[model samples]
Each structure stands twice: as C-alpha cells, then as structure tokens.
Target: MSSKVPIFTLSNGVRMPSVGLGTWQMTGDEGKTVIRNAILAGYRHIDTATLYQNEDQIGDALAELFAEGVVKRDDLFITTKAFCHEVAPDVIEEALRNSLKRLRLDYVDLYLAHIPAATRECGSHRTDVKVEDIWKGLEKLYSLGLTKSIGVSNFNESQIERIVKIQKVPIHVSQLELHLYLPQKAHREICKKHSIIITAYATLGSPGRMSVIGADGKPLFESTKNIPNELNDKNVKALAQKYNKTPVQILLRATVDMGIVVIPKTTNPERMKENINLFDFSISKAEVNLLEAHERSKPERLFWWPNVSEHPEDPFAAER
Candidate 1:
C-alpha cells in the first residue's frame, strides 16, 4: 500500500508523500486509534500541529505501530506546526523542542510556522513580530536538527516575499487552505517559482473545519458561515460520476494531479481506504480543467482566528 502512493520532492531534496492524514480536532484515545488506522490504511505521511493538542495521542499511536513492526520511523514522514506564541522568534526553538518531546521523535520531517500571525500566551495578538524574524528561528531549528525542513503557512505574497528576501534556508513547503472553490493559482505560481512544494489543507472544502476550536474555545469555522463545500459542487460531482468514483475521490485526485499535496481528514475506516486508494486511477487534463472551473470568485478561508487582524501579517485580512 505504501508503494502505491507517489512522493513529491521538496526543494531541499526531501521526499514527502503526496497524500497525508490530517489530524485536526482529533484527540484522546479515540484519536490515537483513528491515527493508527490511517497508517494501516497506507498513509506514510501524517500532519499535525501543536495547536491540535493531539500530538501526544499521535505519539502513542505511532509507538504502538512501531512495537508491532508495522512501520519504522524512517518509513514515515511526520509534519507538525507551531502556531500562536510558538511563532515568536525567541520562543520558536523551545516550542518546537516541546513539540518534539510530545511527538516522541528526535526530529520531524517538516516543521511549519503554521501562520504568519503571532499572539501572546493570553490570546492577544502581537503585531511586532516579522515573518523574516520567525524564518530565522525556523532556520535555527533546521541547523540544530530539530526539524528536517522548515516552511510557512497562511502567508500572503508580500509576507512570503519578505521571508524570501532574508531567508538563510529556503522555505521548503507552504500549507494553505486550497480547494476547488479557491484554487489559489497565484499563490501556486509564487510557490512554484521558489520551488516550494504546497501541502494543501481543506482540499475538499473542509466541512470538518467546523469542529476546530479557536484560542477562546469557540469554533473557528463558525465565523465564516458561507464556506463552499466541494462535496456540494456540481462540477466536482459530475466529474466523480464520469470517472465512476466517489465525489470525495474526484476532489482529492484533482488536487493531487496538480502536483499539490493534500491532507484530507476522516475517521471512517472505509473513507480512510478510499482516500489512500487514489493512486489506482488517473484524471485527464481536460477533466482536471473542468474541476478547476469551479474556482470561487474570491478565496474562501475556513479559519479566521480571533483578533487575527491585530497581527501585522494577517494573510486573510483582504479576504475578510
């Protein structure tokens, strides 16, 4: 099953599996079981964040998989993010070290800044931080062997340019809320120019995002009540029918065909298999074009963190 999945080579020459299991709002013993099941279903890459509060559970699950000889540490690629105060330049290294302790790993395959925004531990946004400052910290982590590669998330073009100007290490990956509704063509082009591999979250419109709580214990997706769900998109459904595959499969396969990595989350055992089985089929260029036709006039973002605008580099400010 692992051999069936294709890999994308990052600019740093690291190999990341195109399809990874997204673990957001997945917690407790139940989350561990689901994570273990995701790997059993053939996922070699797993995405997590310190904000997810489930790294310990994932750590436990992976330990079990290792004990059973299901997978070796090198056989998998694990990516984790540091958000909020963790993005602080001074706190960045310690935050990642703590994350490593939670993940029970010496180093993660990829470590993302998660967002350009920074906040105080009390949830108040901090506007004084610069993205290049944070990039320097991530670069330090890379030098210390804390994370194999470093990148940014939820950054606008200007912010990306700012980091690129002063980067000692190139941004290796860009994880963003990309879906058929908001294909992010411009962002993709910028990343392509920089040779930064994009790891797309919310690829299927992220209905599951509604469950992700914010810093204040409220659902983040509630603020953006009108997100376009790809599951309800007629064009995507038609492509799914034409291809004789589930709509979920069509949407995910299209994103992968674009050379963008996707991490769609699900707990159903059957959906797990379906998500990883995408390698068996292929979508033609014309059909991919048809899917691309559904791009929303404006980008649709699911997470609008509280007081996000207070951060100088709020990437979604224009969208709001």
Candidate 2:
C-alpha cells in the first residue's frame, strides 16, 4: 500500500499533512501501536498534548519507526500543546521541555497554547493570567527554535486579536473543534484574515462515543432516540450515495476541500486507513455547499469545558 498523504504548506513554510492522527484518550501500548499503524497507513501528522498523557507512547512509536527505517525523524509533523495550568509565562518553557522529553524530541513542528484560560494545579481557573502573557512565552519558544510554529486553541476572535496585537511572529495555526455542526465561520474568517491555518479536531463529531454531558449534569443531546445522527443525516447519506463513498469519507472530504486540516481519532486500524485516504477523491462545489449547509443555526460545541466558561478569557463566553 502506498503511504502518501497530501501536504499543505503553513504560512511559515512548514509542510503539514492535511489529515493527522489524533492521540486523545489513547495511551500505553495501544497508543504506540495505533500511531505506528497510522504512519504506515500514510499519516505523516500526529497531534498530541501533555494533557492527553500519551506523549511517551507516541514517542516510542516514532522511535520504533525510525529504528526500523520506516520513516525519518523529519518525515513527520508532530504537534503538542501546553496544558492550561502551564500557560503561565514563567512555566511555559519548562512545560514544553517536559512534553519534549516525553515525546523524545528536541523540537516540535508546532506548539499550541492548549486552551485560552489558565488554571491552577487543582484545576480551578486562575484570574491572574492573560492570553497575551502566555503568547509572549510562545514567542520566546519560537525564537529559541524549540517549536517551528506556535498558536492557540479554542480561542475567540477577541482573544486572538489580543495576541496578534502583541505578537512578533505570526500565529501559525488555531486549532478548534470544527465539524459540520460547528463550522465556526466567524473564527475561520478571522484566521483567514491573519493567514492562520485552522486545524479541526472532532471533525466527525461524536461518531461512536457515548453522548456528551453538559455542565448542568444533563446529556448534551436530549435523546439519541429522536435526533438524527450527523453521520446518518439524510443529506450526508444522500451525498455519500452520490459519491459512492461512506458517510464518514464524505464528511472528511468536505473539510479538506475547504482547506481546513482535520484530525479524526480512532484506535481501529481499518478506520485509521480509511480516514487518511481522503486525497483520492474531490467533493464538488455544489456538494461542498450542501455539506456546509449542514452547520447548525446555533453551534453546539461538544467540548465547551463549562468549568472554565465563566473565566474572563473563556472563548465560549456569551459576549465572545
């Protein structure tokens, strides 16, 4: 099987794979095996975070691949984030070093401020930190060559603007939980204006996972009984039939066609292969619009992290 995935050049001239393997809720031998298989199946990008607690396993997988001559160190694009608690300016470099140690790498392709808000060790939101302060640390990392690019995640337009105003280097990327249900057009427009690439997580939404719960201790979805599954939506199904592709493929292709990078996590090797095979087909403009229209009138973010919603810098705040 050919192990080739399409690449998109970042504003900083770094080449990033259009689709990456996400290592969230995965670790140990299982995480290593899945990451290895993903690379063998043509995934050149791997997204992880210190918060995920799987950097060591991912590192082992990369080590094995290099030792076996399956791929070179420079052949992959690795991305990890600074946990919310580590976003403090004083601790940024130290946190990055810890992540690097775990991933067994000297430098990362990209390093992101995992979340806009800062939190205490006990996981309570800290009101003292500002997004700009954390961004200054990222700038330091960029200048030191520890990370080729630095950016933010789950940040709103105002928060991004705050960083951009004080930024010496361009924000290279802005990762968000983007999908058919939450296209985040406003944020996408902001990123486009600044030439910041958007790396979409949760692209497939809650495919097979248990229903998410909100801050109110209530199910996010009232009932799977009456609501239609996005993957099984009539519109998505119709497009799948038209393209002679699976519903998942149609959904992923739609995101790629929009020039957005998507990372869909799955431990299943077969699903991993299927997720990266998006380069073979193109979704037409009309079909693309049909998929885009699937976006909800009001976004229903699956990972709002309500505990931080009251934080001043909370991107999910009503004012934002």
Candidate 3:
C-alpha cells in the first residue's frame, strides 16, 4: 500500500523502526521467551526502562539470539530508560551503565530519562534538580557513546521547550502516553518544531494499570477502569470491519499513519504477530484524521502517575 510503514529518521539521521515491542510487565523466563518470539516475529525495536526491572531477561533473550546467529546486536534497535532517581546529572551515566550491565549491551540505540522529576531515591521526589542539568547529562552520555540517541519520557510541553532552548544535543525522541483518546496534538507540534520524534506507548487495553507492580513492589498508577476501551468504540469497530482487520490493527495503523512510532506490548505470540502486521493496509488520511478526532473528543486518559503526580516538576500535575 502507498501508506506502508516506513522507518522514522531522527534529527541526527538515526533510522528507528516504526513498530517496536513494549516490554512493561514482560519478565522472567516467560518474558524472555516473549521477547525472543517478538524478534523472530519481525519486531526490530524493543523498548524497556530501568523501572521495568526486566532488562536482564531481555538481555538474556538477545544474547541467545546473537549466539544462535538468528540476529545480531547491530540488526536491532534497543532502547532503555533511566528511572527518576538517576535523573541527576552526576548519577545519570552511572545509572545507565548499570542498566547496560543488566541488558548485556555495550550501548543502547536510545536512552531516555524516565520522567522529568528528579529524586535522590527512586520514589522520593527532589525539587532541586534542573531539567537542563538532566539534558546535559544525557548529552554527555551521547558523546561517550553509551547511547546512540538521547531523549525524555513523560515530560510536558513546557519542560520539553525549556530543555530544547538550552540543549547542547537535540532531544532525538520523546516517549509519551499516547493513544486514541490522548492524541497529544500540542506535544506533537512542539516536537515537530524541534525535529524530535515521538514514541507513543500503547494504552489500547489499560484495565489493569492500577495493579501494575513497580520496582518498589507497589501499584504503578491509578485505575484506568473509567475510560472506555478504544477497541470497543463504534468508530474503531467500523474501521476494523471496513478494512477486514481487527480493531487493534486499525488503532495501530492509524497511529503510524499519523507519523508517530508505536510500541504495543503483548505476551501472546499470536497477538504479537497481529501488532506488527500493520503495513499491508493503509488507512486513508481522511479516515485517520476522523479516527483521531472522533476518539479525542471524549479525551479519556488511561494512565496516571499517582506517585509523582504531586511532585513540583511533574508535567501532569494539573491532571491530579
């Protein structure tokens, strides 16, 4: 199709695969198998964060793949993010090195600050650290070749602009909670102006969000049960029927059509295949716009960081 998925080029000319595997709760031997299967199923990009606590397993999966000659480290685009505790300028590089140790990689293709909020301890928010300092630390990592590209996750428009204004190294990507309901038009525009690519984390089926255990052995976020599932939306259903694809497929393809990268997570091998098989059909520009506009009207948000929501530096502080 004319709208087939294409690799997104970062401002620095790094080619990132449009579709990636999101490893949130994927862990243990099972998680390793799922990661391995996803790679075999055609996903070249893998996203993980130190907060996820699954880097070791992912590293094991990749190591096995490399030893088998099924895939080389150079063939895949691996991304990992440092948690808030490591956001401090002095701690960022050391934290990433530990993550690199766990991931069994010499360097990551992309590295991100998990959140804008800085903390001495992972959960205890600190008001003293500057966002610009974090950017400098990320820039240093890029210079040292610990990460090929640097970026941020869950940063607000203002926080992003402040960094952009002072950035010695451009923010190559921004990871955000983007879905049909929260299409993030404003954030997209800002990133577009700075040539920063965005990686949208899937919120397609967020029912168990509140119960997701964080590294501290507690629920990660508040409940998302109130928001209607996009897969159940009538418009999404209609689109699926018209395209002879599933509702999940329609949502994924429409997002890619909007020029944003998507990382959909799944432990089920069958669903993993379904998520990556989005290139065969093209959702027309008119349809994509309508789809985004339709679901956005209701504007439901599926995830909320209750832990850091009240922190002074939190971008989503108003949402509380």
Candidate 4:
C-alpha cells in the first residue's frame, strides 16, 4: 500500500515528518534510550523543549546515531523550543547555542518559542520581554544559518497575525495543544493560510498525568461535560474493537487522518512502540464521525492556566 501520511512543505521548503516523537516529561538517562528507540522505530523527527531539560539526553542519542551512521545530519529533522529566559535576542542566540552544544549539532531543523506569553511571571523561567523581540532574534539566527526554520507555540490568532504583519521572515510551524477534544479547527485554518504548519502536543490528554481541577477543585474530568467519564467511552471502545487497536491508537489515527501532526509523550517503551504502529492502520469515515460526535466543545485543558494568567489574551479563561 502507498504511504497515507501527508507532509506539508513549509514556506522555507523544509519537509517535516507528520508524526514525530515528543519528549516532554521523559528525561534523564532514560530519554536517550527512548529517543534511540524512536529513531530505530522509524521516527525521523524529534521535538524537544528547553524547558523539558532533557536536551542533554537527546544529545547523547544523537551522538550515538551519528557514530553508528544510521542517520546523517541532514536526514533527521530535530525541533527544539526556545522558551523561559531565552526569549530575548542575545539570550535567544545564547540559548540556541547552548541547545546546539547539548545536541552536538551545528544547526536545528526548527526552533520554536515555547509560549506566546509576552512577559515572564512573578517567578518563572521565561523572559519579561515581548514575543516580537524574540521573533526578531529568531529571524537573525535564521539569517546567520544557525537554524533552518523558526516558529512559535501556544500563540493565538491575533498574536500570530501581529507577528505575520511585522515578520521579515515567515514562520514554518506553530506547535500547540491539539487532540480529539481540543480540535483547534480555526487555529489550524489560520496557520494553513499563513503556510505555518502545526505540531500537536497533549494528543492523549495526558491520561497518566492528572487532569486539572475545576472551579470546585474536583478533577476537570469529573465535571467537564465534554470528556467521557472513562477512557472506554462506547464510541472509542467500539472503534477500538473495529480497528483491533486501543482507544489511544484510534484517537491518534483520527488526528493523523485530519491532516495534523501529533506528538504524544510516553516514557514506556511498549507504549512508544505502540504509538508509532499508528502508521499500520486507518479509521473509516463513519467511525471518524462517531468519534467526532464525542468531541467536547470545552475539553478539560490538561495543560493548565495559572502559568497563563500572566497573558492578557487567554481565550479559554473567559469561555471555560
């Protein structure tokens, strides 16, 4: 059969693999093994964030990959985020240089601003400057050939449009929270219009990580009408049976079918291998509709808000 995965070319002409490995909570010596496993399992792209504090481990895996000659430097598309204190111009370059040193590479495939928050919190690792300053720094880095592509994460439509108006360079990607619950259809459309590709994080709603509490302090899953009470919702379960896969697999496949890129974080080797097996199957249109009906208008935000209260234009704060 032909490859069903669709890869969109960025404005810069970089070919990003639609399905890549996401390393969020996975860190330390264990990350090296997991990353190596992902590469061996056919993942050509790897997404890491400076905030994740695991670049050293990812770097170790890259070194091994280089030594073994399994993947050449240009063959792999490695993406790293510049967040926290690195949002300033000089600091951004310094951070990229640090990330490069950690990964033992000359240039990164894509570098993203982890969050669109213009200022750092009272006590946060982020910088107190605006994103536009960071964008200028990123553009300069691109011109210097330190990075092949530059982009942002968690940026809203207005923020992105503002950047587009002033950007001397085009953004190649916008990494955000996207899943069966948080469809982000409008955001996806805006990115498409600007030729900005989106990379999805929290694809599974982070089942292993505890869900945020609601206004009553109860788990959001308990009160949120959007999420099914249990992972084994009837539609998801039935589809799982039909596909001969798990509910998670069905969800990932559905996301991919919608022409989006997803990076589900998993430390378990077995689950990592299972997640990549998504390439082996397809979900039917009828099944996709069934899944769509389960889509929650306000899915519980697994990644929380106290960190976002600093941003003046948070969409979810007012709606949910």
| Every model: Cα RMSD to truth | 1.7, 2.7, 2.6, 4.0
The positional error of residue 91 in candidate 1, measured at the CA in angstroms, is 0.7
Q: What is the lDDT of candidate 1?
A: 0.87
User: Which runs of model 4 end up more than 4 angstroms from their true locations?
Assistant: 1-6, 118-128, 211-231, 312-320
Backbone clash count for every predicted candidate, in the order shown: 0, 0, 0, 1
Tell how far residue 212 is off in model 2, in angstroms.
7.9
Q: Which candidate leads in lDDT? A: 1
Give the whole-model CA lDDT for all candidates, comma-separated.
0.87, 0.85, 0.86, 0.77
Of the candidates numbered 2 and 3, which has the greater lDDT value?
3
List the candidates' TM-scores in order: 0.95, 0.93, 0.94, 0.86
Residue 290: error of model 3 in Å? 1.0
Sort by TM-score, best first: what order?
1, 3, 2, 4
Q: What is the lDDT of residue 285 in candidate 1?
A: 95
How should the candidates be ordered by lDDT, best one leading? 1, 3, 2, 4
Clashing pairs in 1: none
Those runs of model 2 whose alpha carbons end farther than 4 Å from true positions after fitting are 1-4, 208-228
Residue 200 lDDT in model 4?
A: 84
Instruction: Specify the poorest-scoring 10-residue window by lDDT in model 2.
Output: 220-229
Q: Which 10 residues in a row give candidate 4 its minimum summed lDDT?
A: 221-230
Model 1, runs deviating above 4 Å: 212-220
Please write out the lDDT profile of model 2 over residues 1-320, one tens digit for every residue.
23456677889999888889888878778999999888888888999999889999999889889999999988889999998888888889999999999999999999999998998878898898999988998999999999999999988899999888988998999999888877889999999999999999878875534444556787655443343456877888998898788888888888888989888899999998788877677778988898788766666566766557788778888743
Per-residue CA lDDT of candidate 3, range 1-320, in tens? 01234799999988898888898877788889998898888888999998888999999999999999988888889999988899889899999999999999999999999898888774788878878888999999999999999999999999999998898899999999988888888999999999999999865765546567767886655445466778898888999999999999999888888888999988899998999899888888998878866745456666666667778888788766
